[model samples]
Target: MAHPALKNAWPIPRRIVQRTRGHGQGFITRLMSPADLGQALKPFVFLDIFDADRAMLQAVERSGGMPIHPHSGVATVTVITQGHARYDDPAIGAGEIAYGGVEWMRAGGGVWHGKEMTAGDVSRMQGFQLWLALPPELENGPAESRYIDAGDMPYAWPAHIIVGKYGDVRSPVPAPDGINYLLVTMRPGESWSYAPPAGHSVGWLALAKGMLDAGSTVSAGEMAIFENGEAPISLEATGSEDAVFVLGSAVPHPHPLHLGHYSVHTSAEALAAGERRIAELGQKLKEAGDRQTASGSVPVFR
Candidate 1:
């Protein structure tokens, strides 16, 4: 017998409605939020795909991966597809992640700290950084972080369940119910299908390598937003190269987004609370020297 969540759920075939090319100097990325298309993909707000080579790596190593920053009222999900990277967080400890690895941080109420992630042993790295808006209750809560290596992630052939459930496998990363995220790689001339769970009407995919043919062509450094429906999406590698991409689907986020300089929340009140908490945490970090400790402490917003 199927669980109540899965029972009576059926796959629908979704169609691509919009396509956008990423923008950047070397490692280009498409900023989806603050755009008209952003309203179509709620819960999931911001997206950036960084494609780095040896030159880029050297540049990042020189300046570090963005100075220490602060965030609240949302969770950030980072997935590495090309090479590897390492992260040292006060609350999450330190770990290295290779291809298919993930770094998940929930800045519930507020949090401040950066310089935790750096290029791995490899000379190059490519990956996606995504932001998911938090619900009201969790908007002003405590912050948390997790670094998951590729092997610990569940997979079946070409598909690795990055979040939510797929087949009998479920991701170890904790997240709210009713969302699914997958990292898929199909061999040349190969094909695949994804059937999202019930109520997950919003669907989208961004390719990191190769190409995908879903009636229309989708290539690297591009994203395809699907029309709302329960339809199972069908995709095939169109070129001689394998296709690597990330797919995300979820029930549309219901509340209007209340945005801050570095935060996102469901309501104005929640956003205010989160910003206040961020200010409070900033002061505490300043009082404690706001520097990495000798013993490697895991800092969290209370």
Candidate 2:
């Protein structure tokens, strides 16, 4: 039997950044939060959903794909819902990092690495990748990376805590920028409440599957952004089946966004610096015979 749909009285309108319209090849749908929406919301940045298939994963594996990408002044959070991924970092450790896990890589100063999923296990590859802008002080620190196993994270009756502090249960993932990330799975007819920290400017909810009956019904792939006001915001499942979603809140820091070939920074100058770093790294890889054939057909952004 289908579960009852979730319902909430205060339905906030979600401003879609842009809907992605393709399959395979790193296609992503972006949703701008209050931080990226305007000056009122700063610090949160944006959320991106990247989906891959069996063919795509194989391509990434063959080409040394994603080729030691670089990032600075931001924290990239990757959570794999389906399939699996392996992260091999000389600085950290090595080996396959499976799905349902989280990788929080901070490109404070700068860093380069490649990531790909295990071949032949792409039954379903879905996940959300979030970009959280760092404050000026920490944005230029040394690069760091941490992996959190799904089983290690704390969870309660209605929600799975991924990062930051929730109620009295704090996540194992460190939040250098004072952000909160929670992945909740709600059974039909069940409800959960979350009270975010004061001064936090942004709150976002993304529906993975099933119906979230808050102010309105949200189905798969829809993201809902909320303003600061209410505490303990409630979420209830509206459909006959269980619903899975991700919710996050953070203190915002607004700055000019400059896009580069493989990174985002506060200014064109920073982007240029990042490009130089990437170019030098690429040269080193090539000299070391580390260059692998390009995988899939994802466009290389410049």
Candidate 3:
């Protein structure tokens, strides 16, 4: 039997995080907040979409691109759709993240790393970067990293399971809080249904490409937050092009959040400890001659 389609009744207001208003980057990011960053995005904390033309990508590369940076108290999920990203982490493994490939890295205590596009690899380099926050229990757990090749993820139907499970397909990356991430691609006249666990909270959905029809047409770069509802959130492409987007849900862990330089925790003390740990790791890497510059030095949250 086909699972019941999940409906999104309570409308989630759209907040623009990064917009194409700037001259350089051809994409924008929307940071949904007011709800604690970790709780609201349950299992997911931050999301950024990098989409641009080859000229723009080349400009960014010339501008030094993202530098070696540090992160903690969360996991970074990088999904490449158009181009490739070369990533290196002394703590984890290093490799080239190609189109449709996913690099899942846990910055539990802390980790420093860098990512850049290789020369002559001049594709548009479009993709999404999501930050999944760790709950209080595992906020400072062991740090780790994993990569999923384009072929490894499940893309059987119109939807692709990248981080969790959909129907009979499962993701190689284990979700921490019973959460799942699915990328759905719809034909101009087609649609699909998603049956989420009852206990799970209504997750967040972002329209990456094409328009989504559910009483209203949600255009690209917009996001919808689904509250507990009956009907599955449906979509029908309005243009000749196909529609593609990402949806994620998790067992909501509504807890207070403390934002810090390189981590997110329940309290200031925990955040301090996380930073201290990361500093120590940096020192160790330096001593071992394995330290590398990160993409960006600015802390994500605070």
Q: Which candidate's lDDT is highest? A: 1
Cand. 2 Cα-lDDT? 0.63
Candidate 2's C-alpha runs over 4 A off are: 1-27, 33-41, 53-67, 94-100, 116-122, 266-276, 291-302
- After superposition, the stretches of candidate 1 with alpha carbons farther than 4 Å from their true spots are 1-12, 25-28, 34-36, 293-302
Q: Regarding lDDT, does 1 or 2 come out ahead? A: 1
- Provide TM-scores for the models: 0.90, 0.76, 0.79
What TM-score, to 2 decimals, does candidate 3 have? Answer: 0.79
Best by TM-score: 1
In candidate 2, position 254 carries an lDDT of 60
Tell me the tens digit of each residue's lDDT in model 3 across 171-260: 888657477787777878786556665555556677767877755666777666666433355556667777777777777656666777
RMSD of 1: 5.0
**Whole-model lDDT per candidate:** 0.80, 0.63, 0.64
Each model's Cα RMSD = 5.0, 6.4, 5.9
